[model samples]
Target: MDNLGMVFGLTGAAIAALFAGIGSAVGVGIAGQAAAGATSEKPDLFGKVLVLQLLPGTQGIYGLLIAFITLSRIGIMGGQAPTTVQGLLYLAACLPMGFVGLGSGIHQGKASVAAINLVSKKEDQFGKAMIFPAMVETYAILALLISILSIFGIK
Candidate 1:
């Protein structure tokens, strides 16, 4: 019973990292496929496509940051353990990042694919091509901000 809070906190941390990591993996994989196809014909475009493929990976890093913060906050890494209520709050805080990361990562990957196609057709359009996928990244950044703020705000 006493450890319930720890369980919840750990679960929250896991959710934050796991879901976002899954999202990044899928997103990166999707983009990688597109990149491969695009570069197959014009190997010179490899550098450009590689950048796009890596963009979706930011969400996973954000998730990892949140999880690390959560763990430290809940005393999993050090101090006193959180109360159940605090643990629940931590779980709530992590939700935004988990859900948003998953959604944005996938969508960003799709967007990246489109951008890759655009770049493949028009190499000079690479800057504009980057914008489409970068826009999708905005949501992930917002979620990361909210999760970090929420976690820090929890007493």
Candidate 2:
């Protein structure tokens, strides 16, 4: 039973990692395309587009954090097995951050693409354009918070 708990915890963490990585990959890829298009039209906008391209990276970071928390809760942090129930709780803890980060990241990419278009026309609008994607990042933050709280609640 104890080993089973750890297994569930590790599996959930792995799933979170997978989803988050995929989300970041897709989001960044989309952003990269937008950046390329913008840069091709106006080479001077390269710097602006680069920042947008990097924005999606936060999703990966959040996923990593959730994975770490889950592992820690499973006692992988201390090189021992956690209590059975704790491990099960740890698995549950990882879900919100994983899904929310995944969904938000993909949505952010759309905003990034729009921002790139805005940048193409008015360089000064780059900052304003970023607001859209930045707002989307709030969802990731909420998810991260929930994961952290859930891990703590597991005792």
Local distance difference test scores for all models:
0.91, 0.83
Tens digits of lDDT, candidate 1, 14-69: 99998888888899999999999999999999999999999999889988998999
Winning candidate number (TM-score): 1
C-alpha root-mean-square deviation, candidate 1: 0.7
lDDT of 2 by residue, 1-155 (tens): 54987888897788678787778888989999999988888898999899998888798898998888677667577545766676677777888878887898898888888888888888988889888888989988888898888877765
The estimated TM-scores of all candidates read 0.98, 0.93
Q: Model 1 off-target regions past 4 Å?
A: none
Reference-based TM-score, model 1: 0.98
How displaced is residue 1 in candidate 1, in Å?
0.8
Residue 48, model 2: Cα distance from true site in angstroms = 0.6
